[model samples]
Target chain A: MTKYVIRRLLQMIPVLIGATFLIFAMVFALPGDPTANKCGERPCPAEYVKKFEEEHNLNDPLPIQYAKYMGKLAKGDFGTSFREIPVKDELSERYVVTAKLATIAILFETVLGIFAGVLAGIRKGKFIDNLVLLSTLFVISIPIFVIGYVAQFLLGVKWRIFPVTVNANATGLDSWWQLLLPGLVLGSVSVAYVARLTRTNLVENLRADYVRTAKAKGLTTSRTIGLHALRNSLIPVVTFIGADFGALLGGAIVTEQIFNIQGVGGYIFSGIHNRDGVVVVGAVTVLILVYLLVNLLVDILYGVLDPRISHD
Target chain B: MSTISTRRGNRAEAAAAPSKYQPQDGLLLEVDDLFVEFHTDDGVAKAINGVSFDLRQGETLAILGESGSGKSVTAQAIMGILDMPPAKIPAGQVRYCGHDLLTMPEDERRKTRGPEISMIFQDALSSLNPVFPVGWQIAEMFRKHRGLNKSESLDRAVRLMERVQIPAAKERVKAYPHQFSGGMRQRIMIAMAIALDPAVLIADEPTTALDVTVQAQIMSLLEELQQEREMGLILITHDLGVVADVADKIAVMYAGRIVERADVYDIYARPGHPYTRGLLDSIPRLDQKGQTLSAIGGLPPNLTKIPAGCAFNPRCRMADHVCRTDLPPLREVEPGRESACHFAEEVLRG
Candidate 1:
């Protein structure tokens, strides 16, 4: 198992490198002048363009530019923005905010989704089961931005329950409460998917012959369903959680923008729109790394849940 | 009448009125007039209609029937494990040690389930929890029912594995169900079933999924265990050959009812019901190698709309107009045998 974990960790290096390279290549190919974009509509002198190109190595070949970026990245520098602020300094705080938001969103999604899913699975074919299934489908069909806007309107604009846009200056509890609306919007689709996946797997597990055996053993209803059926049902759910973690991080873009939260999602989104290569590629690389690590953790968790799944 | 109870031979209650309890020498488990029905979209399925049987301690009662004959359903009802809603026992009494289990509270019934009466299923592979180790599953019975601690229960689990004759049980206790072979997995199931030293152990087609040699081994192991524990054994199977040596009394089921029941010798020597006779004749014999095997005519009746009167009448060659019009309740055909057939005497005489 240790060897398996180590192997997975080592495997992440190539994946990260490949992901970064691909983003870099795409950014390199974009038909625009970074220096000119930075200069805005102000008529730039030819010397200023030359000085900007020289400093930023924009005149070099794409491969050489990529190597230079890698060199700076290896030295723990994410390169400076066109406005002269270091990308690392800009992303670090946003990264924490995004991390907290994703964490809370996923936690909410997992807890509520699993609870509803288990209920649906146990009461399969009943009214409650149908109700849960319909709601999940409804959630899945609607887009996140729409969910965000609707949530903002109902809870923020009309009810005045929460601020429509998160407070950037808030600290601790105030910050959490402010982030709640965006988190809910960001997590709505995931909750639906997780609930659906969990319901499907749990319903199947509940019907398994072993469940019958567990009942025959005189274990209480809760013990049989929670311990035996639920554990077996979690493998697929775990897989979904792992695969969706990456999506949640990347997909938080719209929700963050809607709520006006200055998180990595917003950082990356504006960077992509403004064609800020350093911020875009850096955030994407970090997100991919996080995704890879989550998947690895899920595989390890799978091994723990099912003894038959040995790492060897 | 309340009797003063004493524990550890406390003399304080010794002068109280004599205990109302008296030892009765009779059956350990009895299913009287059991009627189980399943309500489905089509209609109600009369799965087990008036099925009756009795099990004595240290004796093996085999309920034999073809697939879908409600043999397993009867066992499930006895164990109180059948899924309700689809299944409903509207009329029946499952009396265990003079206590009606069917009407008992769920908690009391649960108490009786693992510790008093346990069951092993046909497909051991699917019956055993896949994620847990075989020993841990066996130990779970001890932990939940007996309140044994983890380490002690694990020790008991190893002993049970060794008792069931699994090799290297100490080491294999950590092995998962998928790691074990089919025979070994069945052995584990048996180990779990007999863990609590239940008064009655229902083996539902326990050997059907195993090879012939392993089948014999499992039967003998059950026989040995029954002899040691003196527990009532209810072996539910469709195979006529497998139960011949192990079962003391046999109840041959057809269309969810016991068609004939007698000693193992009498069942083979003289079958009182046409269905039982047909089952015996269909068994492949060495002398009948070249001849076409005899088979019962027509399929078993649909449970939703079982044919009126005798369920076996349409399939019985000797079925008469009376057989088609009247359901023959199980009646004494011999001194110690019962048969549910209009012409049971004639069938038995031949």
Candidate 2:
């Protein structure tokens, strides 16, 4: 088992490299120039542009600049944020807010999604199956931005729950409560997609011949499902859940915009708008890393689910 | 949803169905005019129409029939494993020791199915679960029926594996069904069927899917087990050659009814029913050298649109005007040998 895990973990390097390279190329290959964005709307003075250009290594060729960026990324240097002022408390505090919500939302989504899916799949023709079918459809059909706005209207503005938008001036615990509404609105949507994927996977698992044999053994239907069916079904669900979770972690740009949460998603969105070159590329790079890591974790979970699964 | 709910319901019923067949104080199983039908889109496909039989201690009754002969249906009906909707028991009484199996409570039926009267399915590989170790699968019988603890259940599994003659029973008990060959798997199925020492065993086509060599081995194993356990064995099959040496009595099923029933020797030597006679003649026997082997002409009649006179009238060469216009009652062709044919007397006297 240990050898299997080690092999899986090591196998992630190529996947990460491939993902990082793709994201790097996409950002660079886009129409707008990163250096032009760095100069701002009014355009900098000749000397000021030159100084800024040299400071950011714009004088280097495109290939050299890309290599240096990847090199610094390797050394854990995310680079200076594109802002008029220096590193400050406001930005750091906002980053923590988004991270906390993302972590909590992930935990809630995975647990609830997998639970409902497996439960419904095993019971198959029961009420739980119908509930899962309806719930996933309901969640998947709505847009994430619409989900945020609707949640704000119903739970925030009308019901007087959490604040509709994060109070821009809030700090620490106050920020969490202010941002909690957006998290829930967004999390529910992910749950729908994940649950549906899980249900389909689990249903297939229960249909396996082994499952029928388990039932024949006169094992209670529940034990047959729990011990024999659940684990196998969870293997496929892991793939979808991992991929979806990584996408969620990549940040919902519309969700951030509507909620007034200045987290990674908003940071990236604002970076593109304000031509903050460093933040845009840096945010995307973080997402790639997260995506790669999540996939690797899923592969390990697959092995846990089915012992036959191995990297080597 | 409906299909699944019904299957779940049937599974529950099948598990419970056998408990109703359990021996109360003396008798283990009883069936009287049991009628099972298939509810198709067109109409009810009467699979087993008015079939009745008794199973006693240490006796093997080989219900012989070709495909669609209702031998398997009778066994399924007795076991209460018949899937409903597509299949239904319209009217009939299946009583196990006076506990009406058809009308028994669900939980009691579940208890009877495996504990009191278990079944060995036709396709051993398909019937046994592929994921679980064959031993655990066998042990499941002990756990469910006998209420053995986990360790005890697992241990019983190993013992059953050993008893079934699986190689390295201790270790093989941990291997999955796919690891074993066809014959070995059928033995595993046998081990499971006899797990709780059920009062009655319904081995439906147990050796049908096996090779000729494996077929004899399974038949002998069943005979040995039947002798040792003294449980009533109902061997449902089309192979007369295999059952000739094993069966105590032979019940010949044709077109959803028993056309003839007799002692194995009587059925083999002086076959009573036309269908039984045809079946006997078809076997390439060493005793009948240099004789043209007789083959039964025409296909068996479909149960849905049976002939008005005798179900077998269209296929039988002896059918006359009387045979084509009137139904033949099951009557004694000779002592203890009954044949359901209009010309059974003339055929017997010949």
Candidate 3:
């Protein structure tokens, strides 16, 4: 298992290089100059442009520039944004908030999603089943921004239940409290997907031959559904949940924007608008690393869920 | 149908005052006029129609039929594991130890499943949960029903694995179902079925999924277990060769009804029903090599639209107007033999 994990980690090196290169190329290819509008409402002077170009290695070919950037990245230097603020400091600050939001979203989706799914699966075609089906469908069809705004208006403004926007400087429990609404909004669609996936898998497993054998073994309906059927059903559901967690960690763009929470999505958003290649490439690189690690964890978990799958 | 009503009346009285029922005259199970139907999109398919049989201690009764002949349905009904909405028992009485299982409280009926009556299905691989270790699956019986602790249950599971003749029981207890070969997996299934020493063990085409040589081993193992516990064994299979040596008596089903029933030796020597005779003729004989094998004509009737009168009339050589107009009830053709045919005596004479 250790060898397998090491191999997986090594495999990520090529993927990380490819992904970062693509983002860097795209950001550089933007139809504008990075040095424009520097030193206020006008183009920089000829000497200033030359000195800036030389210092940042912008005068070199694209490949040579990328190589220089990578050399600094290897030493943990994320470089500075166009505004002269360190990209590394910006990312470090935002990542904690994003991670906490992702954690809360995952927990909310997993607990409620699985619970609703199991109930709907066992009582298929019943009232609760129909309710879950209709509600999930309703949630899935609507876009996230709409739900986020609507929730904010009703629960925060109208009902006086929560803060309309997250307090950016809040820490610990207070931060979590302020982020709760946005977190749930981010997780809403995933909850629908998880619930539906879990329902479909659970219903199928409930009809499996082994479940019949369990019934013949005198297991109560609860034990038969809970232990025998549910265990097998969760295999695919867990895979979905794991992948969704990685995506969530990348951050919800529209959600962070509406709630005004400082997160990776906002950083990437402003970087794209300003055509700041360093900020865009740096933030996305971290997202890529996080996604790869989570995928590896999911694969390892697959082995544990199903005895048939072996890591070796 | 009249006999079924009388039995239902008796069961009604029995259900009024339920109690801990005891076996009478060694009778372990009695399936009386059981009917199972599935309400599908196409129509209600009559799976089992007026099927009835009984088992006594140490007795082996083999139910023989082709696919969809309600043999497996009967077993599932007896086990109380049939999916209810699609599959419904419109009328039936499954009596275990004089207690009517069909009418008994669900909790009470469930309690009887593993300890009093257990079943082993056709495909052992699919029937066993894929993710669980073989021993843990076996140990579940002891843990849940007997309230044994984890270690005690696991110890019992190892012993059961050994009892089923699985080599290296201790080492293989942690092995998953997919790790074992087909025959060994079937043995594990058998081990689980016999774990609590059930009074009646139903083997639903148990050896049908195994090899020829392995089939014999499983059959003999089942026989030995039956004799040791004097358990009533119901072996449901379509294979005549598998049933010949192990079954004391045989029930041949056609279109969800028993077409013929007699001692295993007698039925093989002279089949009273045309369907039984056709089944016997289809079996390949070494003495008759190079000859074209004879098979029953056409196909088993679709459950939704079984032929009028005798269900076998469509394929029977002796079928006439009388065969098509009247459904023949299973009647005694000899002192100890019963056949459901208008001309049972003529078939028996031939």
Candidate 4:
């Protein structure tokens, strides 16, 4: 089992590197220039362009630029922005903003996702199951931007329950209440999917001959459900949680932009729109890293669910 | 002696009570006219139709039937484990030791189920939770029913493992169900069943899913346990060979009802019902020489479209027009047996 876990972890490195390299390649290919934008609409002198090119190493080929970026990344110096603010400073500042919201969003999503799943599975074939299924479908069908805008208008604009603009000072669980609706709206679709998957897997687990045997063993209804049914039903649910964590973090861009919360999504938003290559690539890399970590954790839990697979 | 509580112990007094609680001498259980029905979208399908049987101390009663013929349903009903709504006991009685099992409150019935009447299942691998240690699961039964503390229950669980002949009982007690082989898992199931020393043990197809060698091992273990406990055992299966080896009395079921019932010797020597005869002839026997085995002629009749009178009539070779139209009531044809056939004696003539 230890060997298997170590092997799996080792295998993920190349895959992640390949994926991040592709993202870097894609960003490199985008037709724009950060220096040109910084230099403004006035056509700068050839010498000024030459000076900027030499400093940023734009004089090198694409592969050279990539190699340079990788080297700097290895040394933990992400270079500087077009205006000369160190990229590390910008990323750390932006990282805190995202950390503030993503933490709450993930917490909300995980709890809600698991709850919805357990409820739907338990009340299977009933109105509650059908309602949860339909509601989740509705949540998933709506675009995240639409969910964000609508929630902003309804809860922030109309209800005045939360501020229209996300407060920078209010942090932790204190501000979480304000972020809750946006987080819920953005994270809810995944919740629905989790619930649906959980329900299906849960129903399957419930019907497994083991559950029947547990029931016949004179174990009380609740004890049988908690001990025998829940743990066995969790493999698929755990996989989804792990795989979707990155999505919830990286993909909540529209939501953060709308809410005006200066989080990771917002950082990526400005970076992509402004063509700030450092922040864009860094955030994407971090997102991918988080996703990889979650997947690793999920793989570890598979062993806990059924020891036979671990023994294998 | 006559001045004593003769009224309390008399068979006549018991017979006057509810059909379920009518206990005879040393009888551990009695089920009479039990009709279990399942209400699907279409209509009610009788799972166990008017089934009646008795279980005496230390004797194993085998109810033989193919899948869906209600052998397991009868056992579940006796165990009070059958879920209601889709399934229900429409009529009849399940009496355990002069108590009406069907009418007993659920909590009271629950007490009897774990502490006095236990069951073993067909699929040993599936019947156990893969996440937990096998012995811990058994210990749970001890904890719940007997109120044993941690160490005591642990010791009892180890003892149960030893009793079931699981080697390295103390160490193996912590090993999960998946660690054990199929036969060993079934042995674990048997250990759990006997943990509470239940007077009546219902083993549903206990050996069907196991290999022949393991099947024999489980059967011998059960026989030994039966002798030790003097418990009433209800062995549910379709295997004539298994019933021959373990059961004292055999209830041959076709569709839902018992078509034939007799002692083991009588059932094997002279099967009264045509269905029973067809089944006996199918088994490859040591006594019969140089003959290709006989096969039962037809499919198990679809329960939804069961022939009106006798459910087995469609598959019964000796069935006549009367057998197709008139339901044959169970009739005593000999001193110790009963068969549901119009011409049971004549049919046995061949």
Candidate 5:
């Protein structure tokens, strides 16, 4: 297992390099000059442009520029944004908020989704099953932005159940409460997917021959479904949830934007708007690393869930 | 045959106090006039139509049938494991030890399972829970039924594995089901079924998924286990070759009904029903190597719309006006033998 994990970690290096390079190339290819909008609305003075180009290596070819950025990145220097603020400092602050949001979102989906799914699966073709199917369909069909805004307006503004937007200055429990609404909004679609995936898998496993054997063993319905059937059913659901956690960590752009949560999504969004290649590339690179780690974790978990799948 | 009278006497006493009844005269299980129907989208498919059989302690009763002939369904009904909505027992009495299992409370019936009655299914790989270790699956019978602790149950599980002839039981106790070969997996399944020393062990086509050589090994293992425990074994199978040596009595099913039933040797030598004769004839013989093998023509009737008379009438060579107009009831054609056919005497004579 240790050797397998080491192999997996080594495999991530090339993927990380390839992903960062593609993002760097795309950001460099975007229209508009980074130096143009820096000095008020007018074009920068010739002297200022020369100084900026020389310092930032803007006159160098794209490949050379990328190479220089990568050289700094290898030493943990994320470089400075166009406004001269360190991208690392910006990312560290924003990533914490995004991490909290993703954690809460994941918890909401895993707990509620699996609960509802097991209920629906056990009582398949009944009223509760139909209700779950219809509601999850409803949640899946609507876009996240609509759900976010609508939830913000009603649950936050109208009902006063939660605060309208997350307090940027708040800390500890107060900040968690503020993030809860956005978290729910962010997790709404995934909850639907998780519930559906769980329901389908659970229903199928309940009919499996092993389940019948469990019943024939004189196991009570609860023990049969809860232990024997549910253990196998949750394998695929866990993989989906783990991969979804990685995707969530990448940040929900529209959800973050609607709630004004200072997360990775908003950080990357503004970086693209300002065409600040350093911030964009830095944030995306960290997100890519997180995704790879989560995927690796999921694969490891797969071996644990199913003994037939050996890491060796 | 005298045990039947003793069983009836016990039944009368059992009716006076049902819960106090116990198996007397070696009557381990009695499935009486059981009828099973499956409610499908098309219609209700009559899977088992008034099927009845009995198992005695230390005796093996082989239920012989083709696929979809309700052999497995009969076993499921006895185990009380049939999925109720799709598969319902409209009318039946499954008496285990003179107590009516059909009328027993679910909790009480559940208690009887594993310790009183247990089943092993076809496709041992699928039957055993894939995620759990083979020993753990066997150990579960003890854990759930006997209230044994994890370590104690696991200790017993190892003993069972060794008893089933699994090599290196201690080392492979934690190995999963897929790690074992086909025959080994089936042995694990049998070990699980007999874990609590169940009085009645229903094997639903247990050797169907195994190779020929492995099939023989599994059968012998089952026979040895039955002899050791004096357990009533219900061997559900399609292979005539497998049943001849192992089964004490044979019940030949066609279209969800027992078409013929007799002592193993009697049925094989002189089949009293046309369907049974067809099945016996279809078995390949080395003596007639150059001759074309005879086969039962046509398919088993669709359960939703069985033939008006006898279910096997469409495929029977002797099917005539009387055969098409009236369903032949399973009746005694000879002492200790029953055949469901209007021309039973003629078939027997032939």
Candidate 6:
């Protein structure tokens, strides 16, 4: 198992290198002068342009530039944003906000989705099953932004239950309350997706022969469904949850924009608008790392859930 | 929810049931007029119709039939393990001792499943949960139903494994279903079934998936255990050759009904039903090595559209106008022998 984990960790090196290189190339290969774009609407002086090019290694070839960036990254230097703010410091400040939002949303999504899904799947074709299926379908059909706005209007404007926009200065419980609204908005789509996934997975497992054996063993129907069937069903759900959680952690862009929350998503937007290669590339690299780590965690969880799956 | 609720309601009635009808002396289980149907998009398929049988302790009753003859369905009906929606038992009486299992409350029925009655399914690999260790799965019967604590149940699981003659059972307790061979897995299944020394043990095609040598071993083990516990064994199978030596009585099913039933030796010596005769003749005999084997004409009828009157009328050579118009009920041909055929006497004269 240790060897397997170590091997997987080694394999990530090439993936990380490729992801960083691709993001770098995408930023540099854009039309028009990126250096001028970085300087904003006003044209920069000849000396300022030269200074920027030299400092950022724009004067070097792509390979040398990549090597230089990798060297800097290895030494834990993420460079500065176009606004001259240290990327690392900026990321540290906003990371907590995004983490809190994603965590809350994912927690709600997982608990509600799995619970409803298991019910619908086990009782397939029954009234409660049909109701859950239809509700999930309705949730899935609507766009995220529209859902976000409707939530904001109903929960924030009319009901006055939550603030429409997040309070940046808030801390602890106040901060949690502020995060809840946008989190729900951000997490709603995932809940529907996961519900559908869990329903399909669990329905298949319920029909499996082992489930019949469990019932024949004199287990209560609930216990048979929960302990025997549900564990097997959760194998595929783990994959879905891991990938979705990683994506949420990457940041809910429209959700962040709608809530006016300052997070990594907003950082990426500003980075793209200002043609800040360092910030965009840096944000994407971190997201890729998270995605890989989540997948690895999911694989490990598979070993726990299924005895047939050996780590080696 | 509706399914479970209705089952629970039935369970309540089972608990309230007046202790009026006692089982015939020495009989452990009595299944009377059992009817099972499956409702599908196509139509309702009558799987088992009016199937009745009696099982006595320390005896093995082999239910012989081809595929789709309702042998397995009867077993499932008796065990109360058939899935609903697809399956529905309109009318049946599965009485264990004096208790009606069909009307018995869910909790009461559950109590009966592993202790009063237990079942061993055909395919062991598919039947055993893939994720749990074999011992854990076996111990689960004791844990949930018997109210044994974890370690105690686990110890019992190990003992059961040893009793079933699983090699290195102490070490193999942690092994999963996929790790064991087909026979070993079936042995594990048998161990679990007999764990509580159930009064009636139904093994639905237990040796169907095993090799010939392993089949004999499994049967011998089952016989040994049945004698030890004085357990009534209901062996459901398609193979007549396997049951001849082991079964005390044989019930031959055709379509959804029992066409013939007799003592093992008598049934072989003289089958009163044409369908039973056909089944016996079809077996490849050593003396007729070069002769082409006899096969029953046509397939079993489509369950949704079983032919009118006798289900075997289409296949029986002696099927007549009387056979075409009226279903032959199972009638006594001799003491301890019954056959469902209009011309049972003519067939018996052979």
Share of native interface contacts present in candidate 6 = 0.90
Interface DockQ of candidate 1: 0.78
Higher-scoring candidate on DockQ, 1 or 2: 1
Worst 10-residue lDDT window for candidate 6 chain B reads: B4-13
Please name the candidate that would achieve the greatest DockQ relative to the true structure: 5
Per residue, candidate 4 scores C-alpha lDDT tens digits across A39-144 of 6678778888888778657768877877787788779887776657887787777666665566666676678877888888898889889988989899888888
Task: Itemize residue pairs with steric clashes in candidate 6.
Answer: B11-B105, B11-B106
lDDT of 3 by residue, A1-312 (tens): 999999999999999999998888877766777788777988789999898888778878888888899899889999999899999999999999999999989998999999999999999999999999999999999999899999999999999798999888897899999989999999999999999999999999999999999999999999999999999999999999999999989978999999999999999999888888889999999999999999999999999999999888
What DockQ results do all the predictions give, each relative to the true complex? 0.78, 0.17, 0.82, 0.56, 0.85, 0.71
The DockQ value obtained for model 4 is 0.56
Each candidate structure's TM-score, on Cα atoms with residue i matched to residue i, is: 0.94, 0.80, 0.95, 0.92, 0.96, 0.94
Clashing pairs in 3: none
Greater TM-score among 4 and 5 belongs to 5
User: How displaced is residue A46 in candidate 1, in Å?
Assistant: 3.1
Lowest summed lDDT across 10 adjacent residues in model 3 chain B is found at: B5-14
lDDT of 6 by residue, A9-45 (tens): 9999999999899889889767767567555688888
Q: What tens digits encode model 2's per-residue C-alpha lDDT throughout A1-312?
A: 678767766877777666666666666556664545455586556787777777767778667777887788777676776565322333455557667667666776788888888878766768989988887888888878777888888888899877877776787788767766777776787777667777887788666645544544445557667877776666666676667667777776777888777777777787667666566677676666677777777777665554444456
Worst window of 10 by summed lDDT in candidate 2 chain B: B1-10
Candidate 1 residues B1-350, lDDT tens each?
Answer: 11213111222212223322221463578889999999999999889989888887677999999987999999999999888988999998988878888988998788777777899998999999999989899999989987879998999899899999999999999999999999999999999998877768999999999999999999999999887766789999999899999999999888889888999999899999999999999999999999999998889999998888899998889999999899998899889999999999999887
Please say which candidate is ahead in lDDT: 1 or 3: 3
For model 1, the stretches where C-alpha displacement exceeds 4 angstroms are B1-23
Query: For model 1 chain B, where is the 10-residue window of minimal lDDT?
Result: B1-10
lDDT of 4 by residue, B129-219 (tens): 8888887898898787677787878888898899999989899998999889999999999999888776789999999999999899999
Model 5 regions lying over 4 Å from their true place: A29-31, B1-21
List the candidate 4 regions with Cα displacement exceeding 4 Å. Answer: B1-24, B286-290
Q: What TM-score number comes out for model 4?
A: 0.92
| Cα deviation of B282, candidate 5, in Å | 0.4
Clashes of 1: 0
Name the candidate, 1 or 5, with the larger DockQ value. 5
